[model samples]
Target: MSSSSRASPVKWGIVVIIVSLAAYYAVYVLPRGELGQAEQWRVLQAVEYDHRASSVTAEPKLLQNAAGSDLSALGLPTGQKTSPFTWILLNSDSGDDYGPIKMLPQGQSFTISCREIDDVSAKVVIEPAVSAYLKSHCVR
Candidate 1:
């Protein structure tokens, strides 16, 4: 074969290899990468409230990007009286969009500590103060 003909085959081979790699990355790696990014955005940071005085505590209330029923749980004065136990969404930096803690309940006797957890779906534990409150309040 002539030198020019031989070079043509080599160039074609390189092109084929490049195309194959591009296809492999698009088919296998691209989707997973996008999913990972989406998951990172979906990661939610929230506070689980525990009243130190009454010992009353509830689950970690997930902070939403916008205000809604979640605000009511935190006793942010959404004009909803659905539940006596009030929660508060203090601060969230898990994402760019975060809701503010609007209204703190008036005359709340118990002191609350809010902490962030890795997994929002994880089960919330009742703190020692909450346990004591439940014990005393649980009437037999």
Candidate 2:
């Protein structure tokens, strides 16, 4: 093959790789990373839970994005709310049987002993407002 033919393949390969990466970032990374998109996902996934809800639990950290800024800290309605119930609703994967959150002592780590079936779970101490919200909304 001529030198230009060899270089043509290499250039095309670079173009394909660049396009693939850009498409991945636009379709996957952008939606998951942006605040508005993340919030939308959170909302769509949300299910109500109350004290009576099964297998629910809360933790001090945002389980979805442990290292990222939490909603509560960001000053959103759900932010800073003790929302183990909401967390449970949000965090459960498809096919995971989730239950109500077990209450925790203030500032203590939360746990999910309430789960009647196998699941990956954790806990966090929730604020009163979060608990109240769950209690009120989860029942309906």
Candidate 3:
């Protein structure tokens, strides 16, 4: 066969290899499930809490009240700050079993106890406004 004819087979082989690899990733690797979904959520919460605590110490005026204090005394209308980081807590579980806690600064670190509410759902509370930022930037 001529060199040009041999090149066609090589190109076709490369195409097949690329297609097979794409199929393997899409069918096997991608669907195996998020390996660190739970861990990732925990880390996100911890980071947000830590950031909030630090922010409170750095800028005392930002944190108005403790988380679980009187909501009325808490800052209202949720003003946006100049900080690049923010945190938010998302209730993935159903029902309103837990008490509503006061809003903390984006820098406070807190220990969150996990409680069962329902099957296939749970709450992942991130401090400040990280959830919004993540949703906007991370999600496609």
TM-score of each: 0.26, 0.28, 0.24
Between candidates 1 and 3, the TM-score winner: 1
TM for candidate 1 is 0.26
Residue runs of model 3 more than 4 Å from their true location after superposition = 1-6, 26-47, 50-140
- Model 1, 54-108: lDDT tens digits are 3323433434432422221232222222323344432321222221221234334
Which pairs in model 1 have colliding backbones? 74-87
Locate the minimum summed-lDDT window of 10 residues in model 3: 112-121
For all candidates in order, the CA lDDT equals 0.36, 0.35, 0.34
Candidate 2 lDDT, tens digit per residue, 25-71? 88776654444254433443332222213333232223433223242
Best by TM-score: 2
| lDDT score for residue 140 of model 2 | 19
Candidate 1: how large is its RMSD?
A: 13.0
- CA shift of 59, model 2, Å: 26
lDDT value for candidate 3?
0.34
